[model samples]
Target: MGSVTELKAADGFKLAAYRAAPAGASKGGLVVIQEIFGVNHHIRSVADRFAALGYTALAPALFDRAERGIDIGYDEASVQRGIKLRAAIKLEDTLLDVAAAVGALKGAGKIAVVGYCWGGSLAFLSATRLPGLACTVGYYGGMIAAHAQEKPKVPVLLHFGEHDHGIPMTDVEKVRAARPEVQIFTYNAGHGFSCDERASFDKASHEQALARTLDFFGKHLKP
Candidate 1:
């Protein structure tokens, strides 16, 4: 349902992106940000799901800036490597890659962004910095608390795990207090609860978050 394509950012950086088109007419476009693990099978599956929902979806390889073609597993070693790669890449560079992806989805109509893990933070940042977005959804983004003071330029929906060790409930509270206008939801799951490939995956939480996210895109991205 999807194919890999090359995209050029404003900085002339060429990166790979997985693009999935709807079977019939597209309702709009969706930019699916990847976890620190890069645009692996899970991320591509996410794009495919959005495509099945009648939206043209694109998942950019954001880790390409530091190291290309990164596809790691959910093991502890992979987690450490992913974190190191994420730390090496700047947020601005990731946003530039996101802009390139949004550009590739031109003419698909209104666009919305959704992300998981490290990508979740990028999604929230995209709402504040990137243009041509109608809305954004983020799931358990640890860095979001650091940027809580940055108001979103577009409508934003955020999901968090109440027991996420990496993202304390205190930080979540800070974001809620700072951005009262944003819609935020907390589940009884842990970090990476939405990813079935992870040990902390919670079926109930993942389904609920996905339902809310689809409804959000429908309300904001569809005409």
Candidate 2:
């Protein structure tokens, strides 16, 4: 249990992060990426949860580049602003921040990454482009639809809602086809089902996805 902080990425960009470490935590490192709403309480709590699991977890604020400390609710206007901020930043630059976070956890054993929504897409890219990560987990990344062709080079896990309107089954299947080596699962939920702050949060789906994610990290990112 600790406080939030900031770290410089590989490209000299400053990104905020929340780090949590548990007692006797020697399990591997996991970087919990944030959603479009920024690294708010939800994301920080996620880091704490991971720490309790006996793994060092860090959640980097990717939105720090576009707008530092931007935490908004899921209202219509907030969603629009979140989308705008998400789109304003380039994918490559975001990956660089992920790389820097990974570096910070270097020599701490194998590393894994878990991301949600927009961060989910970046998580996939992080596993593909960044070095040193043993595994990657992405949840309901709608933007990954456009980049399915960029297959992940590392062991990856993906979770999606079968009823997600923004990300259809066809797109999910395309991503599956593009990267058959990665594990993919579909649930009977909607977009942002993993986030409790969203209207679409589904507890069953969230629990199932978390179990699968932990299992995936256990297999590939075991320290």
Candidate 3:
């Protein structure tokens, strides 16, 4: 249902991406951002899932700028490695990669971004910085509060885990206060609650959040 593709960013950097197309006409295009774990099996599955829902989905390898072919598991060592790779790349570069993905889906109708973990923060930044996006969704982004003051050019929806130690309620409140127009939801779970591969995965929270996300996309990404 998915295959590897290449995208050239604004800087002319070629990066690998996982592209998934729906069986029939596409409802819209979705740029699925990767968590710190890179465009591994989980991210590919995410893109395939969206494709099954009638959306042409693409997940770019943002870490390709640092090192090509980065796919790791959900372990502490992998986390540290992912962090190091993320640090090596700049935010601006990541957004460029995201823009390239949006460009790749030009004829798929309206485009939206959906991200998790570190990609979640990138999703918020994409809404604030990039153009041509219909809407954006972020799940458990830890760096959003620091940039909450920055205005988004499109509608934004955010989800957070109430028990996420990395992102406190204060941060969520700050985002809510700064961007009152953005829809925000909190669950009674811990960090990475939406990820089935994580110990903190919460089935109920993940399902509820996914439903809301799909609804939000449905309303905003209309053809």
Best-matching candidate per TM-score: 3
Residue 160, candidate 1: alpha-carbon lDDT: 98
In model 2, pairs of residues that clash are none
Clash pairs, candidate 3, are none
Clashing pairs counted in every model: 0, 0, 0
Off by over 4 Å in 3: none
Q: In order, what lDDT does every prediction score? A: 0.93, 0.86, 0.95
lDDT of 1 by residue, 127-211 (tens): 9999999999999998999999999999999999999999999999999999999999999999999998889999999999999
**Cα RMSD to native, each candidate?**
0.7, 1.2, 0.6
Candidate 3 positional error at 173, Å: 0.5
lDDT string for model 2 (1-223, tens) is: 6577778987788878888886785589888998888888788888889888888888888888899888778889988998899889988888888888898887667998899988888888887788888989999988776887776778988999999989999999989888888789999999999988778999999999999998888899755
Best-fitting candidate, measured by lDDT? 3
Model 1 regions more than 4 Å off: none
Any runs in candidate 2 off by more than 4 Å, and if so which? none
Tell me the RMSD of model 1 versus the true structure.
0.7
